[model samples]
Target chain A: MARIVTFFIMLVFWVLISGMFDAFHLGVGVICCLLVAIFSHDLLFYGHPDLLWVRDIFKVLAYFPWLFYQIVLSSLEITYIVLHPRMLEIIDPRLVRFRTRLRNTMARVTLAQSITLTPGTITVNMSGNEFTVYALTQKAAEGLPGEMETRIARALERE
Target chain B: MRELQEEAKLRMPWQDVILQTSVRVLIPFIQLFGLYVVVHGHYSPGGGFQGGVILGAAIILMALVFGLPASKHYISENVNKTLSITGPLVYCGIGALCILFGGYFLDYSALNRILPLGPIAWRSFGIFLVEVGVGIGVMSIMLRIYRVLSSAGTIDQGL
Candidate 1:
């Protein structure tokens, strides 16, 4: 019931957004919506939005761009280090674990993805709110869950 | 162990809910945007391959947030099966058509006259249909892969 309503709402929203009011196109859209609905109807009732606290959602959005910038910088640094001939001498691959204060699954996943995107660090395991990370250098491994951790916590309102 | 069980408790079951309200409401727009991507692929950065992946990802997101069963209900196995074949079939058919027109295989420029439009815009219409075919094929294959992997139990248990 709720799924059907959501589908109709989405269909109407799509029609409006696309300005596709032609009978043929609208008919096709409706049919496709029904088809998709028939297949996906079971998805209507699983997760609850109650877990998401919107108060911090926007904060994370704001933080993401900055995080992306850091990711780019780190990627460049890693790329340069990898391209350098003395890369093996510089490489100090080690695994480090740290407990994060961020409580939300979404925040943790985002943080993990960002870390992986940064090139030097790869998130191997996240268990019991503890993250196991593989870092290329000792310097890179140390003090993690440091400033970035605090920033993510702030963004997620985990504190 | 307690924490793990508690985390496990956080997992929702089938019949716990129906379809995703957001996906139901948003799919039309996503599909429309996907169509746009398919149509404009030649002139822009996105081609049939990229657009198809995005479309599949959107549906997958709907499946993840909603439920796999629900997504299957919406997309269906038969349709996806046909789609998987359709991409290669279309590519091959187009190539054959080009051969019939006394051109090389897969030369889409030969089909321009089929639309009754201006001089065959090979980059636009020819590439557009090929892209659409590719998108449909890729999307179906990806969805099938998701189904196979999700059913394997490891996806949910490990994640």
Candidate 2:
């Protein structure tokens, strides 16, 4: 089941990337997609998918808008911080550690990447559910595991 | 906090949830892109060798994150050997086959003796076949090199 999904996905991707509709190109695409799908179907959707993850696919798209918004907002914030005259006075660099509620491995990773993508914070290390982040200011540190975690959970599903 | 740091250091990369999960999500795409590179190599800038490296790098990425032993489970000793041998054989076999069909070595149009495809089509299709073989060879050999280099030629029990 997963293998078929992988094949279609690969085929679509191949077409998009190749930008060709001729029979030969299409035929080769089919062959290559089949080869890869058979080899790594499990890798794409591991542990007995059963069509549940198809819903997650749609749900996960909801995450990008939020993430992009955060990125833009944080980029502006970081720019302001960097351009401040009294940058050293406002910048209170510190390490922030927090345990995450997300149990799924992908969820935790998404949270970590979200945090890093948001300016003023950098994910330095992760151990299990605990993340050690370096924040450039007190404001950033305070936002640890904030609304981002919840948003990611909603988008990707928490295990 | 010191104890926490120490404990974090004790954990291996494969045991880290974030690394493992992110890799799972990213690896299949990486491989698919590599295949894309190989297939598109003729028309595009990249071909079998470059694409083969990408394919090999994907597996190497797996080994790096999952540790040598676990990576072996994914690729296996026997399969790796087969690929390494097969890649070159595919490459050379085509050359020899061309000779048997009355054309010089590697002259793909000569394949017309076996398949009734026109000489012109065979010429084009022949390169694709060679590229596929080369891609497979490169992917396998790249992984083999990494396995040997990282494990100090032991092919076991190291990164």
**Which DockQ-derived CAPRI band holds candidate 1?**
incorrect
Top of the candidates by TM-score? 2
DockQ of each: 0.10, 0.59
**Alpha carbon lDDT at A132, candidate 1:** 76
Candidate topping DockQ = 2
Runs off by more than 4 Å, candidate 1: A1-57, B1-32, B35-159
The per-prediction CA RMSD against the true structure, in angstroms, equals: 9.8, 2.0
Error of 1 at A156 (Å): 2.1
The CA lDDT at A2 in model 1 is 43
Off by over 4 Å in 2: none
Tens-digit lDDT track of model 2 for A15-60: 7787878888778778878888888788777566666676887877
Candidate 1 chain A weakest lDDT stretch, 10 residues: A42-51
